[model samples]
Target chain A: AQTVTQSQPEMSVQEAETVTLSCTYDTSESDYYLFWYKQPPSRQMILVIRQEAYKQQNATENRFSVNFQKAAKSFSLKISDSQLGDAAMYFCAYRKQYGNKLVFGAGTILRVKS
Target chain B: EAGVAQSPRYKIIEKRQSVAFWCNPISGHATLYWYQQILGQGPKLLIQFQNNGVVDDSQLPKDRFSAERLKGVDSTLKIQPAKLEDSAVYLCASSLDSGRLTDTQYFGPGTRLTVL
Candidate 1:
């Protein structure tokens, strides 16, 4: 079984500042995928970013990026210039390269302060 | 494009009662997923389907829980003789194609179930 861990239970960041959420996983598969999802008060699970284990280059979106270290089994999410809208519950997920199911971490609640 | 759609955004039932939630995936999406999310916890996959065919359902409690995706589009999840611990948010998600490495899932608003 694969397990994902998010050590931080809650995190706070001032608006316009940067915040990083930590995540780690245990998997024996060589090829896999890592993801970060955000769930706001609306209860919608939104995809923030994703990284493929085979690719060493990190994945970056408009304001979100991921630091994926396959060897260390760590995948962290970085939010730049955070906004009030960024406040939500962030989750780290893992999926085998050829697998269908996704395993998720407990989750980290992020609060953006004005 | 329209996102995944889930009906009855909220439901309240008593223990040992039965409840069902409905989900309609995006048009042309071949893969659909159902997840259970408790308060303060991340969403957990309960079942997965590909074009009305079961792809994975190992985590589902078959004795009390059941789900089906008929005609490769809409899906339904039912909990029979529900337990108090079954209170949670049920989410539905869909992907264009599970075989594609870049396929990202789009989620619905989720149905919040409260069992007393």
Candidate 2:
């Protein structure tokens, strides 16, 4: 079974600063997909960024980026120029290349301080 | 375009009571998923559907929980004699195509259930 682990249960970042959320996974399959999702107080899960295991170039979406190290099985999300809106419960998810099932990590609560 | 829709944003019931949740996926989406999220934890996939057919229900407690997507669009999940452990937020999501590697799943505002 594939499992995702998010080491940081809570993270604090100041506005206009940068913060990184740590994530690691254990998988025997080499081809898979990783994703970072943000859930605010409203309880809507929003996709922040995505990364394909086969791609070495990390995925970047605006102020959000992921440092995906396939060999080490580490996928961390970096939020730059952190804004108040970035405060949310962030989840790290994994899916096989040919599978629809998504396994998610416990989650990390991000707090943006002014 | 409108995102996924879920009815009854909040629900409360006793341990032995029955409750049901409704979900309407995004227009034209072929894949729909139901997830259960306990407080302070990540969402766990309960069931998945591909156009009215069940793709996966291994994690769903069939003895007490039931879900169906009859018309391939709208879905309903029911729990008979719900348990206090079942208290959680139920989330519905949809994807354009489950076969695509990059298909992104869009989620709806979850329905929070409180079972006492």
Candidate 3:
């Protein structure tokens, strides 16, 4: 069984600051995918960023970037220039390279302070 | 394109009661999923359907849960004799395909269920 772990239960950052959320997974499969999802107060789950295990280059999408260390099974999300609107519950998820089922970690609630 | 849709934004029932939730996937999507997310936890896949056929249901608690997708379009998940531990938010998601390489699941608002 594969499991994702988000160590930070609650994170707070001031507007314009940078914050990084840590996530680690246990998987023996070489081919896999890592993802970060943001769930706003509306409870709508939105994709943040994605990383393929075979890719060496870390993936970045606008303000979101992932530091994926494949060998260590560590995938972390870094939010830069954070804005107030970025407040949400961020969840780190994992999927087998060939399976669509996503295994998610305990979410981290992010609060953007003014 | 519109995202996945789920019905009955919130539901409350007593222990041992039964409750059913409905989900409508995105148009043209061939894969649909049902997930259970309890407070302070990530969503857990309950069942998955690929064009109305069961793909994988290894994690589903079969004794108390059953889900069906009719004609590979819409789906319904029912829980009979609900228990307090069953209280959780039910999320419905759909992907363009069942194959992981091209799968990007879009999730719904989810139906929050509370059992007393």
Interface RMSD of each: 1.1, 0.7, 0.7
lDDT string for model 1 (B1-116, tens) is 89999999999999999999999999999999999998878889999999989999988999999999989999999999899999999999999999987888899999999999
Model 2 chain A worst lDDT run, 10 consecutive residues: A95-104
Q: Write the per-residue lDDT of candidate 2 for residues A1-114, one digit (tens) a residue.
A: 999999999999999999999999999998999999999999999999989999999999999999999999999999999999999999999999996889999999999999
Colliding residue pairs in candidate 2: none
Per the 3 Å backbone cut-off, how many clashing residue pairs does candidate 1 have? 0
lDDT of 2 by residue, B1-116 (tens): 99999999999999999999999999999999999999988999999999999999999999999999998999999999899999999999999999887789999999999999
Query: In angstroms, how far off is B81's CA in candidate 2?
Result: 1.2
Per-prediction DockQ: 0.81, 0.89, 0.93
Best-to-worst order by lDDT is 2, 3, 1
Top model number, TM-score: 2
In terms of docking quality, how is candidate 2 classified? high
Q: Model 1, stretches more than 4 Å misplaced?
A: none
Task: Report lDDT (CA) for all predictions.
Answer: 0.94, 0.96, 0.95
Docking class of 3: high
Looking at candidate 1 chain B, the ten consecutive residues that score lowest on lDDT are B36-45
Model 2, CA-based lDDT: 0.96
- Candidate 3 local lDDT, residue B57: 98
